[model samples]
Target: MMITSYADSALSLLPPVVAIVLAVVTRKVLLSLGLGIIAGVILLTDFSFTGAASHLVSTVTSLVWDDGALNAWNLQIIGFLVVLGVITALITVSGSARAFADWAHQRIRNKRDAKLMTMFLGCVVFIDDYFNSIVVGSIARPITDRYHISRAKLAYLLDSTAAPVCVISPVSSWGAYIIALIGGILTAHGFADTGHLSVFLQMVPMNFYAIFALLLLLCVAIFGLDIGPMRQHERNAQKGELFDESKGLPPGATADLPEADTGKIMGLFLPIFVLVAATIYFMVSTGADALAGEGLPFSVLGAFENTEVSESLFYGSLVGLVVTIALTMQQKISTSMMFTGIKVGAKSMLPAIYILLFAWTIASVIGELETGKYMASLATGNIPFALLPAVLFLLAGLTAFSTGTSWGTFGIMLPIAADMAMGSDSTMMLPMLAAVLSGAVFGDHCSPISDTTILSSTGASCHHLDHVMTQLPYAIIVAVISIVGYTVLGFSGSVAMGFITCSVLFVLAILGLKIATK
Candidate 1:
């Protein structure tokens, strides 16, 4: 008899439990992760007793030594980081980010509209959070300030929308990752008939968190309902005390710097266009064989056959960095200033990168341990057959939230969730998979230590704590609605009907939010 909810399932969850406790106690992410990793090592030690240290040593060693170390996906993520560094360096040197502020200065009149526009900018980028934070923040900052919109709110809007919107959209790289992961899982579990992308698309409706959170953000933007810390930050910004979120900076301090970077703005925008064009072109050329080990060939479609979105951005950024630097020199920025930009960009980003690495490593550890089986067993044991879709939704959310990576969450839970859908005659799989994606995004949105959350704050140049504080209220509102939506979905009797109900409820909730906020 196969058992679910085995003791080992709890073992897999131990790391996150430790991380949260340590984060609470120390308030330092590095220390918290270090402690959590050490706890994992400790647990492995006890699991082996005499071979504990050896097992830990072997695991860490395998991370670097294993062929999986250079797996396409892992390399792609690392490559993306390199590109980010290069692009950020160029933006700072060219002062394009500053020029964007100057441009925004012309359009912004007051805080209310400033907040609204920030939300609009976040929605427009909808494909990737990485693009959302930096592109939107740098471009919109001036307008936000002109309207006396606090940096905190700017960060809130930017951070809030980035991950949530990406997870929900079908055309995004995010969409590809989750869909592909879930598809692979389903294939492993004997449901290999449906294409991964199609399965992923079907599930979008059930992803309550992503849908609901966006709903709340829209509502708040229109009506200006300040909830919790978000409201406090809004009030602070209105009084020109926005910069007060940081202990080190005085209010309106950037007012002193010769603040405009037209070149940086152009440089940033052009590269992004190039990157997107390259990504779309590659996706088209690759067809169905993407990430399936097709080697590079020079044919029009062949060039992109083996290429990934991460690779495209990585290469584009290398070109962009050189161009931005050359243009910066022509703009007569001193060599020292160029170097300073690199220093600042790198220094500012270290904490985020650290969090990314730790989060990635922890997720990797779970995969290595084959812990997903334990998790699946737990789900199968506790959830009723009829309510499987809703249960899958919760499982996906919990996994991603605990792991702090949406892709990883989908990868781990998809196989398990798909297997659970075996007895269902109704079309519940899509909703189940969507729940996985939406739930993962929800956790990533609020978690202070999540990579997207960290990046959004950094891009907005808002204090990290302030971004988390202000955005949490909006996140919670959507979560409440999403939870109700999912529970109703279990008994709604049909997928289409459930989706319609959810959509209507979401719309009404957003409208209600707008009315109350006003």
Candidate 2:
């Protein structure tokens, strides 16, 4: 309040972005984000370095105490990891996951189908990327191996779909995060214009990264349109030249080898079915405004529905888990085996959890430093109006790639993106923000130090370095298309144009690849 004049200079460097660069350099996400947060806190205050340190600690304590304000996506990150661990254990102990794998291996004809279906299944499970990663790997590994699809490709597809699909879907976990993110923006600006939550909601369909990458995955699947380095990797994978099976797999073991008694395949399916039913129920309850009408205020199960909407996905996961546990006994799997899968699954998310706490620390610290408002004014002053989206995208991409974390990117980027929209068309803001998100996803998709990258390598049983080298070329190819798509979108006069142009480029890209292969 006293020195609003210093806000811009104070925000010369964003905390998360710095952490991202540091993470890439050091390969330590937690360390980078923590340091950045500390720096941001120091910058915001007028006090000495010691005073800044004291201020950050005090602010963090206050924010953490609020519980509700510790970033809206907190539970989604925490619960998804824990639940996935439990689900994995249960699915494995029941031998049901193995049966699903056996069925997939039997049906797939070749390596293309193997990787393709893994990607397809990833899209289908779009509600949560974390869920998608563990579940797809849990379900598709066997089929991938039948055709000798490299574990690397399988992990890439899983990693690819995890964020891309969610960011695009209205009812997805990504959508939930964005809504909360933009809602905070609306609150900050004191704007009541329906907050353009719907604007961003609408723009998801137009997001180039989400639309194009998915289409690319499909082309890889159906038409066998492998190209650039991904094709070379796939070829090498088949020859066993760049990969080895003797490493004995890693991370949430791929469902490639059969451990289940096939006759009871249906027995293994109950947990998955139950989980899906619970997710749909959760999505509706939380995003229930769409279902609400002029007269319908309270749901029939108002207490249950109300509980779901208030507590994020954590409450629903609890309910879903209980149902899964109860059903497990009916399936007659030993309790010990289910617990084992849960432990394994939870362990898988450890890296993400580490990044999350550090990210939170940094964002809160930065916020205390008044860096967001500072950067906003500077960007408004110096950057051209037309170039804003591209700038935001580059910033977001750089942060994500360096930090090896999309959520951390969101923590840093969303606030500034939201600030850019103030006093603007809002329609412009939505696509611009979407561009930022896609850019971050693109960066994480290929970042070697990223958790998903590690998980993909582990899930596919591919050597980590090889997966990085092979998948990078394809990531770059799509990134170029996305850049052009976003640029065109920046100039687009209407949201519809943005949507159509992005969709066309993606579809054409898919079709073009198919046609060229023939």
- Candidate with the greatest TM-score versus the true structure: 1
Once fitted onto the true fold, the runs of candidate 2 whose alpha carbons sit more than 4 angstroms away are 1-76, 145-147, 176-205, 222-263, 286-312, 315-352, 362-378, 381-392, 395-475, 486-518
lDDT tens digits by residue: candidate 1, 275-383: 5555455554454355344543343323332335555555555555666566666778766766766655545555556666665555555554445445555676855
CA error at residue 271 for candidate 1, angstroms:
4.6
Count of steric clashes across candidates, in order: 7, 11
lDDT of 2 by residue, 1-518 (tens): 22423344545355656765676576455576677867666566654688777867766565345544664455554666566556555555566656666776677666676777788778888766655676567667657755666666776677777778877764565666666666676677676566445756666765777677777776676676766656766686678643544544344442332233422455446655666667667666654553364345654332222234324345555665676566556766555655665666567555545554555566555444445444434445677666677667766766566556676677677777766766565657676777778878887887655656655664454555556666776677677777766666677645566556667766777777777666
Q: Which ten residues in a row have the lowest lDDT in candidate 2?
A: 301-310
Error of 1 at 330 (Å): 2.6
Q: Could you tell me every candidate's TM-score relative to the true structure?
A: 0.81, 0.69
